[model samples]
Target: MDKIRIKNLELFAKHGVFPEENALGQKFLVSADLYTDIRPAGLTDDLNASIDYGMVCHKIKDFLEQHTFRLLETAAEKLAWSLLTEIAGLKKVTLEIQKPWAPVGLPLETVSVRITRGWHTVYIALGSNLGEKETYLRNAVESLNQADGCRVEEVSEFLVTEPYGYTEQDDFLNGCLCLRTLLTPEELLALLHKLEQEAERKREIRWGPRTLDLDIIFYDDLVMDSRDLQIPHGDMQNRDFVLRPLAQIAPYVRHPILKKTVGGMLADLEHSQKI
Candidate 1:
């Protein structure tokens, strides 16, 4: 990624823990690194191909002046998110919010909070075996599309698959979705669970039939293992229902742990079936 840097742009804002500090206002220094592809802009000599640092600076200043926060942490976080959301061609951002004139009696150069934030690519496997299966899946997709900080980029065609567990229930409508999101893996998982609950999903049996099922299959090549969640989902490579749809959107997405592309995994699965 190429870098566009804006350093120590000053702003006058009323952000502070103390009442006097808020009333009196103070100087806040902001610095940001915009991450994106600059090759096209350089070669084409096109301003539209890259982000304008001047415009971004003005936007940041406006956002800070428009909102009041007591903590620099809050300010930095909000600014980072806003930049990612509002600025086009911006892939990631590193932001620093500095408070140079703190009311501390001791001598200090400055107090600051810094953070890096970016968009993440995520693959989700969706299924429903209960009533109105297609409706459940469609509604789930729509719901995700409407979510904040998330964009539903592509959805694979639904496939009817036999139940994975002991239940002799109806066949499941299964598919996958590719999304770009600002939510962390854990946050995305929580949101999926919430969507399941909204669909009145029950957990009486393992892999049991349900109104809806949503699982996080991949998150930006991340490999994680925890009691509550797992990335590159534990059984994705072996599941045709998951692989088929996932391949439609991201066949070349490499698994961080397995070190195999989705297409490679699917090919391996097909070969195994022949043997």
Candidate 2:
């Protein structure tokens, strides 16, 4: 990643814990490090191939002036999102918002809040066996793409397969997705649950057919296990339905625990059937 640094740009904005500070406003300094690959622009000698720093500075100033927040933390977080979303070719942003005139009675140089935000790659498994399964899957993809910090990068073709568990149910339409998101693992999980509920998904019967089933199979090679969520889902390797579609999109994606690529795992799973 290449660095584009903008240091200590001055701005007058209304953001503070004190009402007087918000009303009267104060001088604030903003700095940012916009991370992106500069090779294309450098080689091509084209301004169009790179993100425009001047435009980004204007955007940051405008955003800060337009909104009032109680804390610099809140302002920095929001601005970081705004820049990361609005700027093309920008992969990440490290933002700092500095307040020079602290209301503190003690002698202090300055106070600031800094934050870093960017997109992360994630793989999600999609399944629905009951009621317009295809529609549910499509809706799930669209819903995620509409989210603030999420984008649907690639989607595997839906594959019809026999029910895995609670086998008495109808066949399922299963597939996987490659997604880019800014949300942390837990935040992404919460969003998936919200989408599930919107699709009228119910969990009354274990492994039973449902309106929609969205599982976070992998999140940026992250491995986690807890009461409510698990990354590199516990049963993904054992289920052909999960691996088949996952391999379609990310054949070379290595499982954090298994040390096997998705394609390799699927091949091994298929080979075992002959034994």
Off by over 4 Å in 2: none
Error of 1 at 92 (Å): 0.4
lDDT of 2 by residue, 23-93 (tens): 99999999999999999999999999998999998999999999999999899989988888888888999
For each candidate in turn, the TM-score is 0.97, 0.97
Worst 10 residues of 1 by lDDT: 161-170
Per-residue error (Å), model 2, residue 173:
0.4
